[model samples]
Target: MASLKSLTKTLGGKDIWMLTLGKGDAESKPAIAVVGGVEGSHLLSVEMALRFAEGIISDHSDVLDNTTFYVFPNMSPDAYEQYFAALKWERSGNARPTDDDRDGRLNEDPFDDLDGNGMITWMRVEDPTGDWITHPADSRIMIKADRSKGEKGMYKVFTEGRDNDLDGTFNEDGEGGIHFRKNLTYEYPYFVAGSGEHSVSELENRALLDMLYTKWNLYGVFTFGPGNNLSSPWRYNRAGASKRVVTSILNDDAGLNKYLSDIYNETVSLKNAPDSGEQGGDFLQWAYFHFGRLSVGTPGWWVPTVKDEEGQAANKDKNREVNFLRWAEQEGLTNYWVDWKEVNHPDFPNQKVEVGGIAPFVMNNPPLAKIGDAARNHTDFIVKMAKMQANVQLVNLKTEAVGKGMTRITVDVYNGGTLPTHTEMGTRSRWLQPVKVELSLGNGQELISGRKIQTLRSLDGDASVQFTWLVKGSGTVKIQAGASHAGVDSQTVNLK
Candidate 1:
């Protein structure tokens, strides 16, 4: 923490931090940014991020020679603190007051612990018109009643609280304000709850974007959030994806996503992972679609499905709550769920009501004791990713003496790694700086052919672009080729 740079203050006055680790000329080297706490309730994300930074500096310091790292450990400090509050619940927004219901009042109907429990659980009321039903296998878990399957609705589930305003909505407004993950620029969900008044409206979002906009050397962005584009690559939809607004991952970028996903699976051992994609205005999509960088995201941890005596995995129905409860039971995790108990409610008379369900943050995050191992696995994965970044090199140089003391120099600038110097969309958008080739000639030397500096759009993997420069009167000339994100390289030539 001492080595981190405080980039800026969020709207809630929390410091947004960045720890840059690298060797000489880090600004010009290829970089990977590891961000966490994009979703405030995901406390494991913050822990994993911090562990990665600590592990890199303590164990994998050698990897920083050619690679730079920017680790943001906690992007939503205000909302993350709720995990330690006296009354705990899964919170995703920051610490700003918001009129979530738009009922001419601010936070008037916030969540209340009606049962006097330390946690905010669910409240289920027995109503024939409700759309929820208890899971047949595990009564503790609840699922939406499938009307098409002839399943009759038996209950209405709501966050545990009373509608203080009598608006008929339960706990719609809460203490925490705008959600950090829901306030990005790409595919901004306008006018939606938690999407904010406009995209990038929050101080935290603006601060992070400002830093990214200035750091042109960043080639990849790795976020620890709800999205899992790293485990399962996003599928491309030609028509809908290629629209002017661009809803899907670009075809070329989707290929890269698959390539990286294979690397992730090989490096990490966790399996039976859930498939989750980008919601509108998420950091993962914003990194690629708007920031023009190769972006990857993961939750860092999830419970693997438990197996039965016959060696088959339990909960084949794919109900998250049911599967989570079964897994918790198999693991002897008794504290995750609270038994439902009848409770009196002010809003309803002569109706059956109860407050109980899975405790907050347990389903999304593993127990604190298990996070150390998970963090170690993620740290290794991130280091592996850094090794695959674009490594540009200058090769195949030839010098020829032309007529009347003119020397013609030729060389090929190549990308030697599997990844391209820039994403296809990045090249198309022209946001990332193109690879720059420059020649430093000695005193009184004049260039006769090629420009002093040449910018190439992009260099594909194992691909090269040849450049020729004709100069007059040079004893020794130094030529350099690369971009901030591509990793620069240089060669010295003696024109005799």
Candidate 2:
């Protein structure tokens, strides 16, 4: 926090911050934002973000010459403190008091650590009509009973607690408020639990959006969260992803997503990854679908699946919990799970109740010791992505004498990077500034062939647009072409 404060101003109070690193010149340059703590439970996300910032400032500051970086680390500090609290649980939300249950009360029924283990685990009640059963391979893990396979239901699972409000639900309402990831506007899941009253209703969400709306130079966004568009691109849904409203990634942007995914796979070598997809009302989707930028996201780390004796990746058919447990055991991690113990429940006086299961924040966050390597790999990937931003340059200059003191100046403006000057959706939305080409003439000189300034909607990778300008009576003229995100380039032409 001290380092960030020394670098940039604190926005939206102490909870939100913005750091801009670059040449600090008048010319607008392309920028990429690295956001962390989109989910409060994922502590590793915050670590990765901070490490990226430190790494760039300490080692890779040269990239800032042409590129600007906006590092927003730890967006959910209020809820993140719960990880170090006396009684810890995987929490996602802010400090604001919320009536999540709609019972006209705030935080009425919070979690209770019944076993005094200082961690909130699961509570299982043995009932004939329950729908959950223990996993066949690992009894510590639970899976829903498959009714179609004639599997008999055995136990009902719930969060560890009693019904504080007598409403027949345990720990339905907690101390934590709105979840930042669940409060975005794009495809907002209305009336959903933890989504808040409306889209962008929270202070952090609105403040971040406000900052982004003013930054016209931002070409891409990278978020460290549960959404994993970086690891695997979303399947194309022509109708849902490409409508005028655009609930899915636009076809062109989807291609970029896949391109970035391939780059990520080549850079990061951790295999047997878990499924990480976009959930509704997430920051990642909102950045692409609504803000109109190339957005990518990932959890940064996941437990690698256990290997078999045949030197092959095992657990192809195993569920996430089962695989995670086996991997944890192989790694000699004993603190991840709490053994089941008998407990008395107020709701079910005569029923057999037990409290135990996988501990919170274990599956999502790896040990702190392993964070450095992951951070370094992710930093390398980000630097590679930065090098791929569209760099517009003016080339192929030619001048001809056309008589009567008139000259024709022609040049090709090209995009030299892998990404386009503007995303397809960005061009269609007309939200991004177009590539503007301007010519500076001498006194009493007038352009006869082309306008003083011309705008192009977009330019694809390795693509160029030709421009010709005829001016009457000019010693020398200057031409400049580019946009905020394309990195402007200028050239001087002589007409003798």
Candidate 3:
């Protein structure tokens, strides 16, 4: 931002403008703005953003000038500190206690690390009437109640421990303050544990919102979270049977789905997917719906698993299972399970603790050994998109020699960034500024062509408008076009 300010000062304050990008813009650029670690445990998100930025700053030059890359290495800085401090936080909120269960108690009870092993793992209680039962096919997994199948559920599954509230609710609300991502107007899992009212309730979220609103040139976003990559099997296959977790259809012009399909398909296999619910206020939806630009959410890492004891190739129908176990072993991700230690919990009197799932710094996060490789691949992707941002285009220009000695000069300004000049009508009503265009004399005292043409106090992609001016005598003029995304452009033509 200081660099932008300095550039603004050098060019006459009029030419160098600073417009907010966020919701109200013509078009956002292909420029990728990454926000990492929305969840406390996911420190890898920060690593991903830093890696991408480091690559851009170090290797790519032309892209730096052409595209504006903004990096918030760790948007959830507070969450990170909390996770590190507690050493056992799997929370996405910022430690704000609310009534997650709606039983009139405000975060009264939550999950506990009963065994004190420095990690929170699932706890199974032997309840005869429990709604969940161990899957017949896989003893390690849990399944929901099924009356039609005549199979009864005997075990209850909770978030690794007993309820702290003492009201009988297990893992309702634990630690942390507030989750900025949940607070945002986008997809908020409201009334659920730590979600505050609107978006940006926490200081960290507010800070990010401030930057996004003020930096209007930001066109595209590549958020690292629960979302999948634009590459591979996950990219190609629709959420299919999983209606709750669906992805936006690809634009016909963007044939990048093939490459994405390969990656997702190649990396992970399906073991189980939790039920999906309505995402009330999602970040990417806000970016796309409000800005009319492409916004993507991607899980930073994935693990493929396999179920074949014979070590045979996976069948067509159950490709996911094969991928999941395969990845867990191949990556050397820790099993964390230590001989099924026996632990007596207030909730479960006779049950054993099983520390399963991809271990810390393993599956969900890249192994320490390959963090560099993960960083390199994503950085390369960011640099590639940055170069693709549209700098400037001559959409339309008209010149007419008036009846006598006057000439009329008309021109249109366009924003080719992936975003719009101004976002939705709501954003404009909020008085967001659109991008502005200007026209002036090339040199000397000659006001022949036109004056400065202004737009939304902000400007986005594919957003453009025209300006015209009537001048006298046969002279020359300069038409300069500028935007927060494309930077600057100037063209000179004779007025004869």
Candidate number of the best lDDT: 1
Best-performing candidate as measured by TM-score: 1
Where model 1 places Cα greater than 4 Å from the true spot, the runs are 308-316
Residue-level lDDT of model 1, residues 1-496, one tens digit each, is 1257888887778899988888877777789999999999989889989899889988898998888888888889888989899999999888788888887788888889988879999999999999989877667778889989999989999999999888888888767588888899887888777889888888888888898888989999999988898778887889866688777778888898898888888878778788664578889888888888999999998988765446444455777788888788888887799889999998988999999999999998898888888888888988888887887899999999988889999999999987899998788678999998999988988889998888888888899999999989958899998888988899998884
* Range of the 10 consecutive residues with the lowest summed lDDT in candidate 2: 1-10
Error of 2 at 181 (Å): 1.1
Name model 2 segments beyond 4 Å from true: 1-14, 308-316
Angstrom error of the Cα, residue 86, model 3: value is 6.0
User: Which pairs clash in the backbone of model 2?
Assistant: 241-248
Which of candidates 2 and 3 is the stronger one according to TM-score? Answer: 2
- TM-score, model 3 to reference: 0.72
Give the better candidate number (1 or 3) by lDDT. Answer: 1
Residue 378 of candidate 2: its Cα lDDT? 94
User: Which tens-of-lDDT digit does each residue in 302-395 have in candidate 2?
Assistant: 9886654465345455678877787788888879989999988778989999999889899989888888889999999999999999999999
Q: TM-score per candidate, in order?
A: 0.96, 0.95, 0.72
RMSD of 2: 2.7
When summed lDDT is taken over every stretch of 10 residues in candidate 3, the lowest stretch is: 6-15
Instruction: Output the worst ten-in-a-row residue range by lDDT, candidate 1.
Output: 307-316
